[model samples]
Target: MSLEKQLNLLKQIDNCFLALNGKKLPSPLGVLDRYLWLHEKAPYSILAQGGEEDPYFIYANNYALSCFKYSLDEILSLPAKLSAAEENRPKRKLLFDKVAREGIVYNYNGDRVDKYQNTFRINDTIVWQLEENDGEVWGQGALFWSKEKERPRLVYRI
Candidate 1:
């Protein structure tokens, strides 16, 4: 895509993000909630949520499902770490640290494995800390597919 087109797409995505963050939507249960809605609307996208035992996937839109060759139920049942190749474990841990300490980060580029363990590149992935109203930390992440052509997007929120 041309730079202009990419910029326009980013603008549209930003608008969607803002709209979702607007008062109409409650504060997300971390990045997962936001990604879940975004992926739903952008069926060509993917979204995953993580937790303690494993990075549980709470959502995966149609496109993501097709890309990974899995149904929604199948994707949700898988762990988020399943997307991380064994060699990338250390990097994933670093990402976890950022989410734990910073509350938010952006433009993270990396590779992720799919349900079948196929690797794909991801760019512009964002991570954000999830907190309760009581100030308790939950988990954090907001990621999307790195492809500029909009082939498919996947997000991991934990």
Candidate 2:
């Protein structure tokens, strides 16, 4: 991803969070520093989906990529619904609906499946609608994390 696009994504996440939570996501002030922190240093799992009838992942930071056991390229091509198992999709849809209506939702807990089909649960997630400066709803974004020990066994690519 281009530096500009990453920076814009950070702005979107920060603005949306601040609008709802009354505080900004903490990061360094400089552009490059903030981008690096988010992608390489931040402890949270961060990701966003593109706006589509069936959305595809548009972004996933290092932590998120690791948690989902997907490479950046692999994830960007994935449908957001696949993040959860088939039986759990209905619940995922409802959560998205709530985010659409409420603009943001905090402390969301849900089960998710990784590329290896191992199931894990996410707790205290923050889900929000991604909106542009002109008020267009672009998609949705999420940020959450769990300790490695708390997550399911991961199957690493050989």
Candidate 3:
């Protein structure tokens, strides 16, 4: 990643954590840049959309890109709405609006689509808005994953 992109992503992460924890946790210093690598290789996916009128992805970790079957460039080039089916977009927009007001929402459930149009459901999601020191809204991010081992989980619907 370019230094500018990396810094932008880290700023959002830092601000999100700040909002969640009531403090700022500084990024890696000197050579401890592994903090970023850890996020990239996180077990679940991490995704963020920009604050445009029609938001497109601005940040997607390696795990998210892998799960969504898109390259960094491809995912960044697409709008976040494409992740959900047409019918699901309204539901997602509602959640996005709620998060815009609530700072964060937990355990959100939703259906998502991949690059090949494969369908999947996400569970135990945590979605939140990105805010900085001056309370500027950068966008939002989500941590979630497919709710299944096979084609579909069929586990718990609640």
Candidate 4:
């Protein structure tokens, strides 16, 4: 939860997120502040990944941590795919691909399984890529919610 020491990394992350804005970058603000705002103010779950040969989760706010039932270190160490059940990975991958190609994909309803095998239906997701100033893809992020009253749907394979 402490990203204060990761100033440069935070800036890079913010820059990647800003790229989703199309041709224009976001207003100037220290990356730390931006991240703090997200960590504190975001209503639902927010998950972020990083640029790596085999990418893993780099960030997850408190709500996300609670939803997934994982501690910060544990979540960050996990592959984001693990968030879904085995049968749901294909749908998740399709969503990932769609986000990569479209820059943003909204209303993505997916069945996300937590660490203890509890399944939750994540609705109204906004998934997008994180790209650097030069358009280099870093990773991705999604803002979504799991409604308590909702049941998890059958994840389609297509």
User: Each candidate: what lDDT?
Assistant: 0.55, 0.80, 0.74, 0.71
Residue by residue across 2-108, what tens digits does model 2's lDDT show?
76786677767767667666766555445456656777666678889987889999888888988899988899889999999999999999999999899899888
lDDT score of residue 44 within candidate 2: 72
lDDT of 1 by residue, 15-131 (tens): 333433432212234444453454444533435364464667654555566666677677767777776798997898798787677655667778877777888877666655545
Q: Order of all candidates by lDDT, from best down to worst?
A: 2, 3, 4, 1
- Model 2 TM-score, all chains together: 0.84
- Give each model's clash number: 6, 0, 0, 0
Q: Name the 10 consecutive residues with the lowest summed lDDT in model 2.
A: 149-158
Alpha-carbon TM-score of each model against the true structure: 0.62, 0.84, 0.79, 0.76
- In terms of lDDT, the best-performing candidate is 2
In angstroms, how far off is 28's CA in candidate 4? 19
1-158: candidate 3 lDDT, tens digit per residue: 57467556855665685577464432233435544643564456778888778999988777788778998889989989999989899999999999988888877988998999988888777788777678888888787766444232221111
Candidate 4 local Cα displacement, residue 150, angstroms: 12
Return the top candidate by TM-score.
2
Distance from true location, Cα of 153 in model 3, Å: 21
